[model samples]
Target: MGVVAAERIKLTSTRSPWWCAALVIVLGLGIGILMAVLSNDTEATQGTDPFILSATTATGGVSGFGVMIVMIMAALTVTTEYRFGVIRTTFQAIPNRAKVISVKAAVVAVVAAVVVAIAAFGAFFLAKGIAGSGPTIRMGLDEATWRVLYGVVLYAALAAVLAVAVGALLRQTAAAIALVVLWPLVIEQLFLLFGDIGKDIYVWLPFANINHFLSAHGSTTADFHWGPWGGLVYFVVFTAIVFAISLGLVNKRDA
Candidate 1:
């Protein structure tokens, strides 16, 4: 608990977290509003699912841009320690190296969850207001609506944890950030350009699974679709595998 608290303090004492939060809020709301303004009324139809529209708006479309900020935070959490030679001091204060990693992961998970939840809700309501009496108006809380909200929150948290795991594995800030950022932004997109096989495989990617979770409807592509709950499970399992590998590397290596 003390270690977690100290980490939280370190995060708060720095300006980066605040700057990241600002960027998330700005992107969440800015992109959401743009989507709301540009979206056609026809998109509010049954096939589109107005609830999904609002949800997507709140989340800055299906691309998960806000999670990118959280991802940066996650990578920096450990990578920053290495950059500043603070890991040795952290190891000295906490003899159980694994415990230190565990606590840092926990702290990041909790904080990312809260931050993304706020951003999601903020974007949702802002879009709702812009939507007005349009087709994207807020439908009362229903199972699907709630599910989308829950999935968005879960997706953000998982992305952050996955980035943290990657950071732990790589130990270099630039490398970790590059891998996390480029994989989704460039690599995944590039892979999807290889025709049907790429599309089939792309759905299995973390960001794609997250998009599936946010959608009220299932995917049209039979092979790619994993439904909401199934997508969540896939993401959790993928993140767990990454985190497990990171734990193994941390245990075997020097700080």
Candidate 2:
């Protein structure tokens, strides 16, 4: 409990959290508004579902961009400590390696959740407001709407946790940050160029699973779709595995 509280305080004291929050909210709202504007063409909504464009645009704006910053923040939570030689002090203070790591994870998860909630909801409402009385106007919380909003928060928090695990495992700021950011943004998408095998492999990637989880209509696979909730479970398991490996490395290595 004390360790968790200390970690929370430490996290709050850092400038990264504020920067991350600002970026998430600013980019989320900005991009969402842009999407709303672009999607305002009623002719485009001719035969399609009117609400889909608004929902997809608003949701994608935040979840797509906001979570990437959260991943960087998570990685820095540990990597920054390493860079500054603060981990030695932290380890000396906490002693229990796993406990300290768990606390950091909890703190990062909470921060990520809060940031995602604000950014996502702000994007949703801002887009809806800018959309005006048009075909792309969707202003209520339907089942799909709930899924998208909830999915943003869940996906962001999970991504943060995974990044923290990666940071802990790698113990290098630049390498961990690059790996965490590029794996989803570039690598996995590149893998999709291989057709069937790529698609199958994409299903297992965290970022792909996140997209599946947050898809407004619930994404489909060639053979199966675990659905949003199932995708969440899959991501949790994946994060847990990486976290376990990180913890093992932390236990074995000296600070």
Candidate 3:
């Protein structure tokens, strides 16, 4: 309880987390409006088929860039502590290095989950409201729609845990942030450039699986051995392995 409280205080006392939160909100709502406006325009010009807005399209910014920003904030939480030598103090107070790291990850993960959930739903409703009365807009709280909405929150929380682990391992803001941001946005996409082999390998990649889990029907072309739930489990297991490795290294290395 004490460690958790301390971690929360450390997270909120900083201005960067607040700024990141605001940016996520802006990205969520801003992109929602953009998608809604575009859908409206597409419908206006279309002759036969109308443009249908799925849950996936509506929350694109929240799940994509918003989640990335959360990961950056999560990485900064640990790297910034190391930067100012606060982590050493924290270690002295907790003694159990693993406990401290675990608590930090939990705190940040929870906060990220909550923030992204709000952003996800906000984006969905805002987009629906803007797109207004149409056979094109299909933003219902159906099973699939619910999955996409909450799946984003789940992914954000897990991604935050991964970011915290990366930060603890690297203990450098720039490197950790760059790796987390680029691995998903750039590096993951680059795998597709390798042609058939890349496509095969892409099915097993962590973020690719995440995309599969969040995607609407026929939205993703990757041929996976399992279903969306299985893809999520694969990502969960991968994150656990990385986090476990970081825990081992953190205890073995100096603060």
Candidate 4:
């Protein structure tokens, strides 16, 4: 539809989104190379799977950082308009404010997802190159590496959508981003410190549980898993619930 295409163009025309996309690629690959270089001389610990360490380290600790930035970008993308009074112009142009927001959400989600996928694959190859032939697994179209390859992108994109939903509640980029980022790190940690319930309750913590994707270990609970696809599922459900709540707000709000 013309509306969707128009929305896409508007979304992509912005410089920040493009720079964020570039940053995702550059930071991701940069970390991968750093991991390979730092970890090159180190052999896989005997009895431990090299692939696990390879996945974890060459992928590195920066994985969580990408998700947070992605969420911040999403939050800022939607909520910033409210602060700038751009929402009035956007709605005035479209007239169908509901559809505009819906399309905007969909457009942002899809674009972020696609960019993350490309970045993940690019990072994989960049890492593979730095690793050389040293203690490396086979890379091909039909390998288990495919899971790791796509999971990075899937997780990042989902994080953005979830943030968009959360942003809708606040409608302010700064507050939404602060709350979204701090929720898992600070507040969740505090709640999780209380007792045994902390472990169980925190296990379902939306963004934190996403790391379960990268874990070779397993989930702590039944309701907390989607199996090997757990990370993807966790993010999907989180994104959906957030978006649903945002939809209610969107319907109620002026723009």
Candidate 4 residues lying further than 4 Å off, grouped into runs, are: 43-52, 133-144, 189-195, 216-226
TM per prediction: 0.88, 0.92, 0.95, 0.82
Ordered list by TM-score, greatest first? 3, 2, 1, 4
Preferred candidate (lDDT higher): 1 or 2: 2
- What TM-score does model 3 achieve against the real structure? 0.95
lDDT of 1 by residue, 79-132 (tens): 999889898999898888878887888888778888778777777777767766
Off by over 4 Å in 2: 42-52, 133-140, 220-225
Best by TM-score: 3
CA lDDT, every model vs. true structure: 0.77, 0.83, 0.90, 0.68
Using lDDT, give the best candidate's number. 3
Q: In model 1, which runs have C-alpha deviations exceeding 4 angstroms?
A: 40-52, 61-63, 135-140, 220-222
Model 3, residue 136: distance off in Å is: 3.2
Model 4, range 1-255, lDDT digits (tens) per residue?
Answer: 877997777777788888877777677778777666654545542346554335545554346555566777788877888888887887787777668767777777787778766656666677667666644433334434666666666776667777777777899877898997898668877755767777667667765566666543444432463565766677678778778878787778876
**RMSD of each candidate relative to the true structure:** 3.2, 2.3, 1.7, 3.5
Query: Model 2 misses residue 146 by how many Å?
Result: 0.3
Q: Cα miss at 141, model 1 (Å)?
A: 3.5
- The CA-based lDDT of model 2 is what? 0.83
Candidate 1: residue 226 lDDT (0-100): 50
lDDT (tens digit, per residue) of candidate 2 on 1-255: 889889888888878799888999899888888777766766665574443454656867678778888999999999989888999998998889999998898889989999889888888888777776654566567987888888789888888889999999988999998998788889988867888988888887877777777777767653336777777788889999999999999999988
